[model samples]
Target: MVQHVWSVNELGEWLAAVRIDPAIFDLRPDYCAGLMVVAGISSGPSDTDSDQWLQAADSCDIDLDDVHLEHWRDAYRSFGAKPNRTRPSADALSRRAEKNGLPRINKITDTYNAISVLQRIPIGVENLDAFVGPARLVRADGTEQFDTTNDGLGVAEHPEPGEPVWRDDTGVTCRRWNWRQTPRTAITDTTANALFIVDALGPDAHQRAAVAIDTLRTALATGTPSATRYIDTAD
Candidate 1:
């Protein structure tokens, strides 16, 4: 559909529209995020390459002692979230890999999840077509809607006031920074255009995010006809 019909200018406009509020930086100065847009992707269920990559990530020697994981834990604490109860995405994935291993979602989602665990960064991928407006990272005012699942059924939730969240014009896409994602913009098998958000914090945050960005680019090359990367960071 529109994903197959994307032009260079349209991708540029989409990249330019992504923004991180300065007030978010006021809370965590080391916060850095790499946002990438991929068009004309060959999306489907996970195949050999994705499955192997996830297996490798699961075999990695990661634990809660990791500095990156601790950094995210601290960031969550600063935002009034209990990291032990709701861990950061990467931390949660790493923990899951140690136990039952990561779930085989889809091609794009599997690739990003593998990279997230391997690089120790929190990563999120969204179906670009589901987005209503430009994506933004900001401190929520508690008014935005977050469409998520409770138990096995769909439910609507809202972020706490002053929580760091990613949102489009419609509502929150991710809450508590990288703890949870909304099902509204989740990537699916038919998703051809995608938006990836890679997050890093603490020492070498930008460098870590850059490395994760490059890894995602290389890993997705086989499926993407064209990939564009744009990084947003705190000053």
Candidate 2:
């Protein structure tokens, strides 16, 4: 399998160019368990690369006028978080967001939804397959296990401590489940499309996820100047 690392600049550039206008599409977010994966090309079935998706809100291109940065603040008001939980992990932060109805959004909005959230459902898409398979939600037991980080170039496997990971049946890896992707599986300049979803851990999740995915697909198809496909995670 080929390993790649997408540097912050590279990822940001992709987000900037992502088709958002002339389309009624919205970004969806959901996270569950300990997992995250990439959204595009894999050379083969055994090929799994460290996949990481950065929040579009963090990017300058995302519009925050209607929606503030903290969209999930109200979602967590009813649900209680750990008292001492300052700087909640991606898993914790996303779980709170899920309780609240995720709004229709742009690239940033759609990017992080595939993983994290209370339901723990990380969705992944490839250019071909409906949904990612041969996928496994496992974390590195210790620092000794790690995928490469995208420094804008390419990366190799290295030792990582306490770094949780989502790996495919193959050796490709990413870090912190849905939070960050290692360089190895990181999306790069070559990526044309992606398979994305958040890990889910709830009962009503499928229905909710389907609504968001379907809405996004319709919106995207209608809005984009070019044609593309969107698949529901539950499918």
Best by TM-score: 1
Candidate 2 lDDT, 105-140, residue by residue in tens: 323233434332322334433321211233344324
Q: Which window of ten consecutive residues has the lowest lDDT sum in model 2?
A: 19-28
In model 1, how many backbone clashes occur? 0
Candidate 1 accuracy as lDDT: 0.84
Q: What are the per-model C-alpha RMSD values against the true structure?
A: 1.9, 14.3
Candidate 2 error regions (>4 Å): 1-133, 150-164, 169-172, 188-190, 222-235
TM-score of 2: 0.38
lDDT of 1 by residue, 1-235 (tens): 3544666678778878788899888898788887777777778999998998899998998876899899999998888989999999999999998889999988888888988998888999888888888899999999999999878999889899999999999999999988888888888999878888888887688788888878877787734344455444543
- Pairs that collide, model 1: none
**Residue 10, candidate 1: C-alpha displacement in angstroms:** 0.9
How does each model score on TM-score? 0.93, 0.38
